[model samples]
Target chain A: AQRVTQPEKLLSVFKGAPVELKCNYSYSGSPELFWYVQYSRQRLQLLLRHISRESIKGFTADLNKGETSFHLKKPFAQEEDSAMYYCALSFTYGSQGNLIFGKGTKLSVKP
Target chain B: DAMVIQNPRYQVTQFGKPVTLSCSQTLNHNVMYWYQQKSSQAPKLLFHYYDKDFNNEADTPDNFQSRRPNTSFCFLDIRSPGLGDAAMYLCATSSHRESYEQYFGPGTRLTVT
Candidate 1:
């Protein structure tokens, strides 16, 4: 069974401060991790994936195989960055397109 | 623009009544998925269609059903709505059935009364 755990339910930070959202996964096979974001009055969209290794909106996540973690980080947070972030894991074997998501973390960037 | 679209942004259904949620995509993706997201919880996969092939989760209740008439459209049918069934139902599409980046719709909020 593939499982994703997001430790924080709510994270508050001041504008221009660094922010990190923790995520951990438990999967036997090679996992494909992704970060999805949902802003107020917006649909859930893919922020980035471990395979892409590309930063989106100044946010980046590194997948650590040894620690089984994929933490999302941003050097400087903006007030518009306030949103709900979800970490997801995917297994290619049986459930191909289905994503196992973690309970989302609500990020509040105060100005 | 190529995107996933879900109909009826909000739905109100009576308990024990059947409700259907529709999803369409202009992306022409081969895979479409349905997910149930409860308040403060992650979106859980209910089922998916890979080029017309239906795959349902093992633990998904029998009350839930799905239909894929074609590549661009899919529907989720809830045979009997319950209080617990009230949640945000999300529809997503991807180009492939593997680990491709998925495009999600603005989810349909279902409220059972």
Candidate 2:
């Protein structure tokens, strides 16, 4: 079974402050992790993937296999960064190709 | 823009009434998925279509059914909606079965009275 856990349901940070959202997963096989963001009144969009190793909107996440964690972080938070973030694990084997998502974390960057 | 699209952004259906949510994609993706998300909760996978093949989650209720008439369109049909079924229905598309990135439409909000 594949499970993704997001420990924080809500995180409040002041503008220009550093922020981090925790995420953990349990899967027997190798996992492909991804971070998705949903802004207000917008559809869910892919923020970044572990494999890509790229940063978007000043946010970055690194997958740690030993710890089974993929935490998203940013040096400075902006008011526009306030949104819902979800961590997902992709089941690439057997053509399932479905994403197992975590209970999202709502980030509020107070200006 | 070439992207996934969902119809009837807001839908209201009476309890025990049947309702269908439609989705279409111009991305020419091979995989299409439907997810149900309640307030303050994660989106639950209802089912997906890999081209013409249908895959349903084990815990998905029998009252929920899906149809993919073609590669560009998919539909989620609720046989009888209940109060609990009121939520946002998200439609997503991917280029391949193993593709990591998925394109999502602005989900349809269903309200069951």
Highest DockQ model number: 1
Q: Between which residue pairs do clashes occur in model 1?
A: none
Full-model lDDT for every candidate: 0.93, 0.92
DockQ of 1: 0.65
TM-score of each model, in listed order? 0.96, 0.96
Per residue, candidate 1 scores C-alpha lDDT tens digits across A47-111 of 99888899999999999999999999999999999999999998883345479999999999999
> Per-prediction RMSD in angstroms?
1.6, 1.5
Point out the worst 10-residue segment of candidate 1 chain B by lDDT: B93-102
Model 2, stretches more than 4 Å misplaced? A93-96
For candidate 1, the chain B TM-score comes to 0.96
Worst 10 residues of 1 chain A by lDDT: A89-98
Candidate 2 clashes between residue pairs 3 or more apart in a chain or in different chains:
none
Task: Give residue B110's lDDT in candidate 1 (0 to 100).
Answer: 100
